[model samples]
Target chain A: MDERERINRLRWRCTRRAMLEMDLLLGEFLERIFPTLGPAQADAFIILADMEDLELWPLINGSRECTDSVQAEVVALLRDVRVK
Target chain B: MSNSSIPVRKFDAVIVGAGGSGLRAAIQLSEGGLKTAVLSKVFPTRSHTVAAQGGVSASLGNSEEDHWHWHMYDTVKGSDWLGDQDAIEYMCRMAPEVVVELEHFGMPFDRTDEGKIYQRPFGGHMSNFGEKPVRRACAAADRTGHAMLHALYQRNVRANTQFFVEWMALDLIRDESGQVLGVIALEMETGEVVAFHAKATIFATGGAGRIYYSSTNAFINTGDGLGMAARAGIALEDMEFWQFHPTGVAGAGVLITEGVRGEGGILRNSDNERFMERYAPNAKDLASRDVVSRAMVTEINEGRGCGPNKDFVLLDITHLDPATIMKRLPGIREISIQFAGIDPIQAPIPVVPTCHYQMGGIPTNYKGQVVAADGVPVKGFYAAGEVACASVHGANRLGTNSLLDLLVFGKSSGDSVIEDLATGKVAHQDLPENFAERTLARLHRLNTQTGGSDVNETRLELQRTMQKHCGVFRFKDMLAEGVAKIVEIEKAVARTEIKDKSQVWNTARVEALELDNLIEVAKATLVSAEARKESRGAHVRDDAPDTAENPNGRDDANWHKHTLWQREGSSLSYKPVTMTPLTVETIALKTRSY
Candidate 1:
C-alpha cells in the first residue's frame, strides 16, 4: 500500500477504537445519571452521540487528518459529559 | 489536638505504600476485620510494581515433580550466600501457598490445558545444585507483575480497604519513648497536612531506582519511605547492592522484560553473533542479571555494540511467531512503540543496562518486625515490600524473586501485625514537635529558595553520574569519585528550588519532596558501594580484579559478611553483616556460570 493509504488505515483503526470507547463511557454515564429523559431529548442525545462518534472516528482513526471542526465536536462531547 | 488545628484520621492499621507489598498487606488486614487505609503518592495501578516484567518464583504443581527445596537452593545460590538462611527457608516453604492464594484471588496466571499454572525457566533457577535449569517462575505471559498487582488491587476493592490516594507521608509520628504512633501526611490536591493515628504502620514503599537517572523505575519510585525511615534513625540494611536489569531500551532506560529472553529472544552484536556465549557458555542468554549486564557493557566498551554509535546490542525477537509475540508481549510492543518509536516485529530493539531494584532497605526479621538502629525491635512499626529487606534477596535478587518476596513477606507481615494487635495494648502518645518542624523546614526550603539550580537538572545530573561510575562495572577509585560527585550534587540539591509555587495541584512540590528522598537514598548507595572491597554478585570491583583473595585462605569467606552503612552527619559508618542460622547445609563456593 501507498504511505497515504497505510496512514489512513492506521488512523481508521485508532479512531474506531477511540470512538467506541468514548460512546460506551458516555452511554454508561447517561444510563446511570438520567435514565428517564424525555423521548425527544433522548433522541437528540442519540443523534448527537452518533454525530460525535462520526467526528471522532475520522481523526482518532486517522482515516482523515485532524480538523478544527472535528476537534471542536470531540471537545463539546467531552464537555457535555463533564456537565452531566 | 484540637479538631480545627489538627486534621485527625484513624484506622486500625495504616499501610504507607500502595505497591505490591502494601496492597497485599491491605488485602489481608481488611479481610481479617481491621479497618485498613493504604496511603500512596500515586494511583495504586501506576506504582512501580507494574514495571516488573518477569514472573514470580514458585515451585507449583506445573511439572508435578517440582519441589520447594529446589526453589530454596536456587534462591540461596542466586543471592550469592549473603541471603539469611532462615528468611530464605521461610519464604521457600511459603511459596507454594502464596502462589495458590494468588491463583485463588484471580491472578490470571497463564495456565496449561490441564488447568495448572504455567511455569517458565528464569535465569539462575536450577535443579540438583546447578545440574540443569528448572521452570520455577510462575508467570502471566511477560507482564507477571502487572497481572499480580491488578489481581491484588481487585481483591483489595472487594475487601473495602480505604484508599488515601495522592497523599504523601511527610513523617512518622513517634512518641517520646521512640514508639511509632502514626504519621503526618500532605494531601497532594490541597497541600493540607493531616495527622493520621493508627495502631500499626506498615511501610510497603517500593525501591529507590530513581536515585540513578537512567533506571527502569517509574517516576514515582523515589525511596520516600526508606529515606523517612533512615531519617528517623532506622539503619538501612545492605544499602549498597543495587540490581541493574541487563536488558533495558538503550538511552531511554526502559526495561525490556527478561521474559523476552526467557521466551527465546537472543542477544546479538553488530556482527550478528550470539555474544553471551563468549561470557557464559552454558547459560548463554540465561546467565544471571549481574553477569549479563557486565557482558553487555564490556561488549560496548570493546566496540562490538550495535548501531553507528556502538552503544547497545540487539534483542532479536523477529524470528518468533507473530501470534506468540502478540499474546505474550502486548505491553512490551506498546511500550517499545511509544517510547523507542520502533516496531519490534521488524527490527531488533536496541537494549542496554538500567538501574532496576534495590536489594536493601529497612532491616526486618522474617516476621516483618522493623529492627531499630541499635538492634532493638521498634514497637508498632512494620515493613514489607521493597522498602523492607527481610534478607530474602541478599547481595543480589534473582529475576522473579521480587514478586515472590512481595507476596510471601507481605502476607507474613500482615499476619504478624495482626497477632501483635490482638495481644498488645494500644499505647497512645502525643506527636513530637521535632517531627513537624523537620518536615516544615524541608517544605519551606523548597518553597522559598529562589535561586541556585533546578531540581530536575540536579536530579538528571545525579542519574548521569550514577549510571556512568557505579553502574555495570565499578572500581574503588571510580566509586570514590562517584561518591564525591554525589556529595556535591546532594549539596546542590539542598540549595535546589522549585519554580511553581502554587499550593493547588502542585506536582512540582511533590517532585521536590521526591528528589529530597532520592538524594538521601543516593548518598547511602554511594557510601555503601565504596565500603565493599571485593566483587560479589551485582557489586563488582574492577580495581580488585580477582574474586579470590589470599591464595591459601578459604574462598567466599572475606565476602561472607554484608556491608551496612549508617548515615552519620555527612559521613557513613560501616558495620559487619550478620550470618547465622545457616540452614540446609552451606553450598561450597564455585565459579558462577550459566
Candidate 2:
C-alpha cells in the first residue's frame, strides 16, 4: 500500500521476464529507469507491468500505439530507453 | 576477532545438494541418530533430479522375465567395458532393494495389470545378455525423477533432517593432516560465510552439463562438489566421457526422455527412414545413448536430416496409440508441446543430441568413499550421485541406471558414515586458524572488483568453445585446439567479475562462483579428451574408427585405464579399472555393436 513498497514490487515484476530480451531491456536499464520516473509515470507504471511480454514488447517496439492517455505517458517514457 | 564475525556450525555429517542422492543420504544420517545438514542452492524438490523423466532401473521383473545378471551384463557392454565391474555388480544387485524401499516410502510407481510395479524398456536395458529388450525401468509414468525426489524429501522431513536451502558451498575444508573436515558455505539471505564442520562430508552436487552450449541439465547442475574437490587437490576420474541424450528438442535444448523410444517412439530422417537400423541392427531406436546420438549426427551430416536447416532428426510417436502416449509418457508430450511446439500424437518432434550427463566425477569406491589416485580413501570424504564416479557408468551411462546409482550409493555413503561414527574415533579435528581464508579471498575479490570481464559473456564464450570442439565426433587436431582454447578461457574466467554487489540474495555472485567450477569441468573434459587416443563409450574420435580389428577403436592395451585429472600442475594420471565383481564372474569385453 505504501509508495516505496509498491515501487519496489513493480521493479521486481519488471526485471523478471521469461524472454531474455525483455529482461535485458527492462533489467539492464533498471537503475536508470527508477531514478527518473515522474509522478504520472510512476502511478501508471503498473499498467505496463500488467501486460504480458508478448503484448508489451510490440507496444514498446513501435508496432502499436498506447490507446489510454495515462498509459501512453508511461509507454512514451519507456520508449525513450534503448533496449540492450 | 576476524573469526568471531563468521559463524561456525557443527554437525555429524554435511551433505551438499538435495537431489535424490543427497536426500537419500540425509534419511540415513538423520534416522541413524546423527546430526545431519543438507545444503542446496535450490529447494530440495527443484533440484535437477526433478527433471529426470523416464524411470529408475530395477530388475524386479514386473512386466516380464528379468534378472539382475542380465542388467549387469548390459551395463558392462553399454559402458564399453570402461565401467569398473565391481561397482557395476554392486549397483545392479542393490537396484531391486532400493526401488522397492522407495515404493514403501510412498513413491508413485505405475502398476501392471496384476498390480505389480510397471516397468518399461530403456536404452541399453536388454534381456538374456543382450538378446532382446526388456522392461526393466520402473517408472511413475514419465515423471519418475520428480516422484522419487518428492518421496525421498518427504521421508527426509519425517526423519528430521536439517536443511540449508538457498545456500552455496564455496570450498572443501581439510585439516593439516589431509583429513577432510567440512565445507565453508555462504548463507544467501544474510551473505554470511559459515564453516559447517562435520565428521563426514557427502558431495551429491550432481553433474555439470551446462559447460556445453546446449544441455538438458537444469541451470543449477554446475559441478559444485567436483569443483571444490578438484581445488583441494582431489582427482577427477574418467573426465572425458559425456553423454549426449539422443532426443533434446532442437534449438531449445529441452530433453525429451529416452523413455519415449522405450514406449515405441521411432526416430526418422528426412526421407522418413528409421536410420538407426543401419547403426544398431538389434536395438535400433533402443540402442545405448552414445550409439543413438552418433547415428543422429551422422544422419544430419550426410544431409538426411529433417527440418529447414537439415540440422535435426524427427522422433515420431504417431504410431503409438494416443491413449498409451497419454498414460505412459504424459511428461514427454507436455515437453514436446511446450519446447518444440509439436505434440507427439499429432506430429514428430524435432530432435538433436544435446549434452545430458557427465559419466564421470570424483573417483569413489563402491562404499561411496572418495578415493585417491593410489586407491586410498580420502579421510572422512564421501560422494554419490552424478558428482561421484563409482565408475559404474564407465564410459556411457544407461538411461535408468543414473537413478539407481544415486539411490544405492547415497545409502551406501550414509551407512558408511553411521558405522564410522559408531566407532567413536570419528572426532572433530581442530580447524586451521585460517580455514576460511580462501573462501573470504574469493568473496572479497567479487565484492571489490569493478572493471573486469563480464561474467555472463565469459560463460557464453566458454560454452561455445566446448560445444564447437568437444562435440559428438572429435578430431585429433581439433581436440588439441580445443584444449588450447579452454586454457585461454580459463584465464578469462579468472579475470571475470560481477557488477552486482548487494549483500542479500546475490544470484550474480552465485553465478560467478559457479563459473569457477564450470571452468574446471571444461578444462578437465578437453584436456582428458585430447590425451586419450581411443574411442570408447561416449568418447568417440573420428580418427580412431571402429575397424574390423580395432572393434570400436578401444585401445585396451594403451587406454583401458581410468583418467585422473588433477588441479595441481594441471596434470593427468591413470588408474586401473577393477575387473572382478563383488560376486559372480566378471563380464568380459567384446566388440560392442548394438
Candidate 3:
C-alpha cells in the first residue's frame, strides 16, 4: 500500500486509550499518520489501540481532515485527553 | 517536643535513606511481618544506587571455575590489606545468595544461553593468586544497579511497605540517656516537622561524593546520613579514603561504568599511546580505580592529555561491534547521547576521574549494628549500604563489590532489626526540645541571614576547592590548605541566606540544610585525609610516598587500623583503626598492577 493508505489503515485500528498512552492529540495522530510515517507512527499506533472505537472503514474513507465540523470534534476529544 | 503533645508514627522498623540497601531491607522486613517505612529525600527510584552502572560481584562459577574463597582473597587484596578479613569472608559467602535473591525478585540480569546469569570481569578481580582475570561480576547489560534497584522497589511495592518520599531527616531522636528512638523529619511540601517513631532505624543514605566538585555522584548525594551521625557524636570510619572512578565523562564527571573497559574500551591520550601499560603493565586498561585515576591525572599534569584544555583523555569504544554496544551498553549510549550529545558508536567519549564513593561511614560491626564511640551497640539504631561501614569495603571498595555490600548488609540489617523488634521491650522516648530547637534555629538562620554569599556560589567554591586539593592525588600541605578553605566555606555557609523564603515547596531551605550536611562531611573527610600518612588504598599520600618512609615500620602491624574522625564542637579528633577478628592470613603489600 502507499504511505497515506497505510496510515489510514493504521488509524482505523487506533483507539482513544492508545492515543492517551502515546501523549498525542487525536487529529494530530491522524494528520501525521496520513502523511509518510516517521517517529510519530509508533506513537499513533499505541494511541489508536487505546480508544473505544475499533472499526476500520469509517476512519479509512472519512474526509474529516477536509471538513471543519468533524475536525473540531476530533480536536476536542484530543484536548480533553490532554487536560487529563 | 513535649511527651504528651509529641506526635508518634509507628512502624515495626523504619529505614532511613532508601538506596539499594534501604529498599532491599524494607522488602525483607515487610515480608517478615514487620510494618516498615522507608524514608528518603528523593523518590526511591532516583537514589544514588541507580547511578551505579557496572555490576554486582558474585562467584557464579561462570566462564571459568570460581569459588567463594577466590572471591574473598581478591576482595582482601583489592582492599590493600586494610579490610577486616572476617567481614570480607562473610560478604563473599553471602554474595551468591544475594545475587540469587535479586534474580528471584525479577532483576533482569544479562543471561547466558544456558539461561544462567552472565558474569563479567571487573578491575582488580582476579583468581589463583592474581595469576589470571576471573569472571566474578554478575551484571545486567551495563545497568546492574539500576535494574537491581528497580527490582527491589517493585518488590517493596508488592510487600506494601510505607514510604515517606521527599522527607529529609534532620536528626536522630534520642532520649536524655541517649537511647535511640526515631528521627525528626521535615515534610518537603508543607515544611512541617514530624516525628517518625520506630523500634529500629537503618541509615542506608549513600555517600558524600559531592564533597568534591567533580564526581560521579548524583546531585542529591550530599552525605546526609554521614553528617547526621557525625554531628550526633558518632565517629566516621576511614573518612579519608574516597574512591575516584577512572573513566568519568571528563568535564561533566558523569561515570562511564567500568563495564566499558570490561567490554574492551581502551583509554588513550593525545599521544595515541595506551598509557596504562606503563603504569600497570599486566592489567593495563583495567587497573584498580585508585591507580588508574592517579595515572590519568598524572598524564594530564605532564601535558599528554587530549583536547585544547587538556583536562581529560579519550575512552574509545568505537572499535566494539555496533550490535554488542547496543545490546550490552544501551544505558551508557543513552547517557552519552542525552548529556554529551555524542554517540559512542562513532566517537571516543571524553573522560576523567570524579569523586565516586565514600569508603567510610557510621562505624558498624559485621552484623550492621551501629556501634557507638565507646564501641557499644546503639540500641534500636542500625545502618547499612554506603552510609554504614561494616568494614567490608575497607579503605577502597572493589568495582562490583559495592552493590554486593549493599544487598548483603541491607538484608542482614533487616533481619537483625526485625529480631530486635520481636523482643517487644523497646521503650518509647519523648523528642527532646533542644533537638527541635537546634534544627529550627538552623532553618531560621538560613531564612533570617541577610547574606554573605549565595548558597549555590559557596557550594560551587567548596566543590572546586575539594576537587583541586583533596582529589585523586593528595599531599599533607594541600589537605591542610583544603581544610582551612573548607572551614572558611563553612563560615560563609552559616552566613548564607535563603533567597526564596516562601514556605510552599521551598527547595532553598532543603538546599541550606543539605549544605550543613555537606560541610560537616567535608570537614570529616579532610581531617581524616590529613591524619593518614601512608599510601594505602584510595587515600594516597605524595610526600609520604610509601609505608617504608613512615614512622610506623610494619604494614600489617601499623596501618591495619581504620581512621576514625570525630567532630568535637568545631574541632576534629582521631582514633586508631580497628583490625579485629581476622580469620585468614593478611595479604602483604606487593606491587599492585592491572
Task: Name the Cα RMSD for model 1.
Answer: 9.6
Encode model 3's per-residue lDDT on B453-503: one tens digit a residue: 788888888888787678888867888998889889988878888876765
DockQ (0 to 1) for model 1: 0.04
- Tell me the tens digit of each residue's lDDT in model 1 across B1-594: 232465778788889988889999988899999888899876676566765667988877486467777877777777766777778878888888998999999999988888888888878887776678888888887677778888999999999999998788877777777788777788866778887888888999888887775576755678988878877767778877888878887766666878898888899998898999999999999886767888887787679898887878888888998788888987677556544657688778888888878998988888888876556668888899899878888878887889989998899889977888888744445556555666667777888898667878998988878876688777677789998999899889888887777665566677777777888788888887787777766777766565345221213655566555566564544444444444566444455545
Candidate 3: docking tier: incorrect
User: lDDT of each structure?
Assistant: 0.74, 0.84, 0.74
Total clashes for model 1:
7
Let me know the TM-score candidate 3 reaches against the reference structure: 0.78
At residue A76, give the lDDT of candidate 1. 41
Candidate 1: misplaced stretches above 4 Å? A1-84, B1-4, B257-292, B295-338, B341-351, B547-555, B570-591
Query: Which window of 10 residues has the lowest lDDT sum in candidate 2 chain B?
Result: B331-340
Model 2 pairs whose backbones collide: none
Residue B353's C-alpha lDDT in candidate 1? 87
For every model shown, what is its TM-score relative to the native structure? 0.79, 0.81, 0.78
lDDT, candidate 2, at B492: 83
What does candidate 2's lDDT look like per residue over B295-343, in tens digits? Answer: 9877886899988878789999999999999889876776576567687
Stretches > 4 Å off in candidate 3:
A1-84, B1-7, B256-292, B299-351, B546-557, B569-594
Residue B292 error, candidate 1, Å: 4.5
C-alpha lDDT (0 to 100) for residue B129 of candidate 3: 68
